[model samples]
Target chain A: MLKLRQGQAAIALVCVVLGFMLAVQFRTAQDIRSSIPFQRIEDLSQRLSQTEKERDVLLKQVYELRQTTGAESATKESENIKMGAGVVAVRGTGLSITIDDSKRLSKPGENPNLYLIHDEDMLKVINELWAAGAEAISINGQRLIATSEVRCAGPTLSVNNTRYSPPYEILVIGEPQTLENSLKMRGGVIETLQFWGIQVSLKKQDIVDVPAYKGAFRFEYAKPIKDGGK
Target chain B: MALPLVGLIIGISLGVFFPLTIPVEYAKFMSVALLASLDSVFGGLRAGAEEKFDNTVFITGFFTNALMAAGLVYIGEGLGIDLYYVALLAFGLRIFQNLAIIRRYFLRK
Candidate 1:
């Protein structure tokens, strides 16, 4: 009986170690599955897709409204105002520009960030397009309006509060030949971008479509001042 | 037997309450160690049932086997040879054999 008791103590100690390890291993496996970075990425992608679906539905409604509205002079004037305000999608012969990060590897000791597309680079391209008389402009399907902003949100570009990853596709509605000449001019935006190994491709298409702005226009602070007696 | 079962429950609850976490990189090593310790426990149980339990041998074997299994995994990662499978297969086979022997010993008694 004494011998049995001694053996039982040894077995009990070993069992303790085994049980502890088993619990820890189970917890570790569960931790790996729900790691913070993995969960964050999944959540972000789900929100992105949801917002895109919502935009598509709103775009369909815009087209339906345009179709249902009769050809009266007042309705025609409102349609023109909507087009100018970038609230309605437009299609015309224009230029489609694609800008992406450089595929070329940087030399040792050089800054790798130079190869990436920056907010300023995109802003410069948009400014050039506007100067060349682009009637409408959209980047990665997000339209540019009077209140639209082009800013950097970490590694991604945020246009009008919506974030997009490269390669950025800019669609414009204008005279294709004129737009192309302005961008491809000597020592222009394209040449500057190419010098740092950034990839820029400009295509002159017969028809280019730019999506309308999907965000709301809030005027809570600034009431429109009457030019004269209303 | 009841004492060992109670010890196991205590150990599991202790681990749960400690809030300790190992990094993801060392998880593989922890798994190998867990397998080794499990195999040792069963081997010790079988020896005890057969009336041949040695305290020194049981304790040393438990530590040495767990450490060696973890070392093998580390070496395998360095050499890029995947020696983890070897340790796993050996320990797995031993656990089943020890369980069967313990079961037979109880049946005969």
Candidate 2:
């Protein structure tokens, strides 16, 4: 009887762990249906086209607004600056750079972080691109702005407060050849990342469209100083 | 036996109502661990039916088997080979065999 009673403790403990594992698996599969699970690939492509159409309509409205508000001479210049700052989605012939975690298995003594891409890697690459005259940049649908912060969130990267994982796609709108060359220059960001076994690829494209910033901009302390009709 | 069954019921209910997420990397380890635990439980059941169940053996096997199986999977992942499938196949077969024995024991009565 004593032996039987003792065995029961083990039974209970094992069952609890088993139940927990099963539950976690169920939750993971449900959580990672990879977003828009209900929508097929065809539906997603169709949705993309719909969003593009909407953007066109908004652009026309902006153009009409500028024409009617002809009193403000600074409007056109501010609009151009807004587009360069990633407030508006901009399309141009530029470059696409993709950085992903190395698939190679780490050596027994190697630090796993060496093979993984970090937030600093992103900041470095973006900084280099900007220096090369990238008009606008977006990483994994998270548009880069003056306030955008590239940070490490556990095993993932967070850009502008949105979390993303490896294989980060960076779309830049500028001179494609110049941007690509700057990134791949000897002793540059590409070589530095490659030294850590990080997979980096720069591809020049005929057209690269960058998404607009999706985050709200809050400025409490830095109030705009108006020239007041200079 | 009653206490253990009650504990199991409580566990499953808690798990169902309050499921938690683990890291994606640990999924394989969790699977193999669960399989190993199931194997131990069934073995214990078989031993009890045959009047040879040992508490020490059951409890030690319960913890060690799960951990060892999970460790093998972790190692295999590092080595670029999946060891969980092997553990799964082996544990799955043993679980069914032990279950069959327990079923037959009840049928004999």
Give the winner by TM-score. Answer: 2
C-alpha DockQ for predicted model 1: 0.27
Clashes in model 1: which pairs? none
Give the lowest summed-lDDT range of ten residues in model 2 chain B. Answer: B19-28
TM-scores of all candidate predictions against the true structure: 0.46, 0.52
* Every prediction: chain A TM-score: 0.66, 0.65
lDDT accuracy of residue B108 in candidate 2: 78
Chain B only, TM-score of each candidate: 0.96, 0.91
TM-score of 1: 0.46
Estimate candidate 1's RMSD in Å. Answer: 17.6
Estimate, for each residue in A3-57, the C-alpha lDDT of model 1 and write its tens digit.
Answer: 2434788888888888888888888787666655664674477458758977998
State residue A94's C-alpha deviation in candidate 1, in Å.
0.7
Clashes of 2: 0
lDDT of 1 at A191: 69
Proportion of the native interface contacts kept in model 2: 0.38
Model 2 per-residue lDDT tens digits across residues B6-106: 76677677777884765455666877888898899889877876778788898889889999999999788768677878899999999999989888877
Q: Tens digit of lDDT per residue, candidate 2, span A144-177?
A: 9988889999989998988999899999987787
lDDT of model 1, residue A230: 79
